[model samples]
Target chain A: MNVVGRRTLTVIALVALAIVGALTAEWWLSQSPDRPFGHTQAGHVLGWAGLLLMLLVLAYPFRKRHTPGQRWSKSLFQVHIVGGLVGHLLILLHAGAHLHALIPVLAMLAMGLVVVSGIVGQVLHALAFRTMNEQRRLLLHQGLPEPEVEARLQALAKQEETFRLWQVIHGPLTVTFVALAMLHIGGALYYGGF
Target chain B: MTWPPPFSMYPVLLTATLVLIIGLGWASARDPESFWAPGDLSVHHAGRMSCTQCHEPFRGATTANCIACHADATFISQPDSPPQIFHRQAARERARCLTCHTEHRGTTARITTDPLNPHSEFIFRVTGTQSCRDCHAGVQKPGPKYGLLNNDAVRRLVAKGKGAHGPGRFADCFRCHAGGRTGAERGS
Candidate 1:
């Protein structure tokens, strides 16, 4: 498929996931009493599932470093991205609309920032290819030899490396989110909640 | 062209994250009593600054702590006195007060955590074509004062009527059959 079509599909999928999260939250709030979200069975399920998915997302870096026999790195990377998104969705549900407590709110904020930064990084990487292709075609038309054209493309690629700065934001935010999640879970246990 | 991180940013990010986590842990440990509270307590319990008021140090809140304040005569003297009679019944059955009266819910949270059928408060089990409203009409009478039609106030009214109706009359039927079932000797 074309680059624009692929980007559109990604956007649509993200939007769909967001809608699902919204509807689920609305239904949960409407159907249940205004109790603490973390205390309910549904909240517990969401919390555990989100935690599991987040741990699975951490596996991506390791998987990318290896050939891993039959499984492909590209597929694993896609799973990582999607798993992080859905995991954050579950965490949002676990928090519910009433973010009354300070610690939990901070944790949720960190998680949200991490997910947003990761999405921006993904978009930049996907769209960078189209920009590179256009530049390469233009250089070739200008009668540059194949080797010179390749060299110019390398320079352009180097310029686009600015997007890698997203990792600085994404990585720290991920750590903060994980730390806060641990705190939240521990606090829950200490307070005699599951 | 500046190539983003240039391989030096990773260390900086890692260090910052480590510092933040350490700071958070330090802050948390500074107060051994600190933990994420579930939510706000009820208005009457607003003065309770610590979990120890309701919860035990580590073993968690017991029914004994609940009975300490709740079973006080002054507290029970209040109009909305929390059905301590029912609580006594629950205690006899070894039921925890927390089962029904969950705290930290919210300011206006109705303390009944579980569905408490009012009929459960009766001495005799309400069965066989009986509904709660049949005996307890005006139970939720909404004005300022307790309406004279239902509840213990009505029980008092029945006791007075028994004396006026000249002893051993039908006050017992007044419980189930209501005021209409009683005839002219009914206390005005």
Candidate 2:
């Protein structure tokens, strides 16, 4: 499939997965009136596992900046995407339908925002990268001088920089989510006695 | 110009979320119940809004904190109730107040019962039975009485031997057994 078609399919699949997950959680909670599974030992284990996976997602950005190879960056990106989505699903399960606490509810909202913003950033980045590569190939085919082609690519890069503006929102949302998550954990520990 | 303009609503929305999160944190620090409490405290405990009143740093609402206020024998000792006896005996060693009475479930919430699941240990430890049906087998019909009232341990402690109030005599154990000192009072 073409780039646009592939991208569209990816976005649709992600949205569909999110919707299905949400509906499943709702159905599971509705199965029981007390909905006490979130407080069970199994629920807590799921929460801890999800939290660890989400924390691992941060390694992608760190590795991307430090690793001097494209291959490793690509693999880490995949890990970041998969780990984030799966971690989010586990967290949603751990949360169940217990929406009584304000701090935890806020943390969930922040987490959702972070995931949405990250998905948006991922799509835009993919599009920009593909467009830049295609433009570079076209410039080469046109028999432009190396220096001239380089200059044109630099200009294209500048234009593509607009796509990165999603990071401005994504970065802060991530920090907010982390902070709220920490507070939620601390509160649980303080009040849970376990 | 791209799908997302340089100035989009994304930034505005992000700013609002940040502001709300920060405001919530600040408010919670000042009064945790406003934004941190899972639910409202039961009506009896409503006046004690401070989390630290029952909660100790890193320890949660310990049985010590609970017994601090509820030192009365009425709250601790009920020989007829195996759960109460177990809790009173093991308050320091094994049982926690939160095991049975969980708060922050909204005012009027039943804090006495385990809202999540029945305490399986009660049946296992008190009745020495695995399933509820083992003890409540004939509860449906007028066959044989079951449960803790007929348990040997309870019978021995309540109305069988010397120093035990005879059966059908003391309807209220506390009437004569007042001030029998709790485990907490003994500093055990």
Candidate 3:
């Protein structure tokens, strides 16, 4: 078999393991002859992965070692944003969309806020990327902060002048998102499972 | 056919539940489409595994995985440590992974930590605060042993209170706490 066929079989095996894991979880749930213990393990797999995945995605880019002026920055950030958004979707599913529990609710809210902030930061980051590119394209002074100057040097694309602003704004928003994410997890610890 | 209660059925029940769950999960895995969006890439990433990786598995399809991750955390019980502990066993009677997690339901469940125990307070007051009473009573021995707390006020402080300067606000602290920073309701 070719590489593709080999990879396909591996994927199939993983699926099989996942099914076994699920069934194992179900059995664990059923073990509580009197208390419904086994009954619950049946449903916890995805939520765990979702919460962790979102945090991992959010932290990956800035956590990576990269030069500020590198070309890969834009692509890296786009990946970060997409990963974060997808992770959040998984987390919501993991929680079963229930936040009635005070601690869990607060945690979920904090997580939600972090994701929203991440979204805003992604937009700002994109804007910054565009601005930096324009600054590069026009051969303007990297130190120069004026859009008009950048415009005059080039064809004066409206997009050119606004890039620096995005760069400046994204920094603070990303920091806030990180801080909120910590609080969300910490608060979840405080409230606990009943 | 042992009764599934207390300690007797622990092993059998656990095993049986495991088998049943394996079967159900196996059946669910046969289909790739049930796990995600039409052609979701993550499903492929998961190798077609069901959504139980991070979640807690219960009887059928519950998903409360929070407790599994946060069980050992002190935040689940009390904010501050008490002078006495009632539940001295330390997670002895706490809920199982599934009881607290119960998954696939929703993220909004009312997550709550167990409260601190009350008996520890009762035990602490009786032993610690009264430690000096033995020597300070002056009638027992000569008093000069290791010298930890003020043995002089032996008879008075226990009856009244003992603070840095002198005397405490709450009169019957030992009546509640039980012992010195140790008792039944330790982490409540």
Q: Show pairs that collide, candidate 1.
A: none
For every model in order, the fraction of real contacts preserved is: 0.19, 0.45, 0.00
Itemize residue pairs with steric clashes in candidate 2: none
CAPRI verdict on model 3? incorrect
**lDDT by residue (tens digit), candidate 3, B1-188:** 11114477679857976785576457435752232211222212245334444422223222234335444454446432321122223345553543332223222211211222222223234445432233223222222232324454444534443332223322333343332332323432
DockQ of all predictions against the true structure, Cα-based: 0.16, 0.22, 0.01
Tens-digit lDDT track of model 3 for A1-194: 85445654574475446445644544454443222221133334555555566556655455443443444555656567666655655545444333333334444566556655554454455555466576565655546556666555456443453444543444444444444445444433332222
Model 1 ranges with Cα > 4 A deviation: A1-30, A34-37, A64-72, A132-159, B1-35, B53-82, B115-188
Q: A1-194, model 1: which lDDT tens digit per residue?
A: 97676876787687567957764774566454435666677678888999999989988856644544445477778889989888888877777665665677788889878877787778776688678888889999999999999888878765664565766677667877888888777766666533
Query: How do the candidates score on chain B by TM-score?
Result: 0.41, 0.42, 0.21
Candidate 2: tens digits of C-alpha lDDT, residues B1-188: 23223477779867987897688668878878756676778776997657887988777787777877876365365443444445556554656667667777666444655422132232244335554344343232222233224555455444433544454432323233332211112211
In candidate 3, position B22 carries an lDDT of 76
lDDT of each: 0.63, 0.67, 0.42
**Fnat score for model 3:** 0.00
TM-score of 3: 0.31
Where in model 2 is the C-alpha error above 4 Å? A1-23, A26-35, A67-72, A144-155, B1-26, B75-94, B114-188
lDDT of 3 at B38: 17
For the predicted complex of model 2, DockQ is: 0.22
TM-scores, all candidates, are 0.63, 0.65, 0.31
Please report the candidate that would top lDDT against the real structure: 2
DockQ for candidate 1: 0.16
Docking class of 2: incorrect
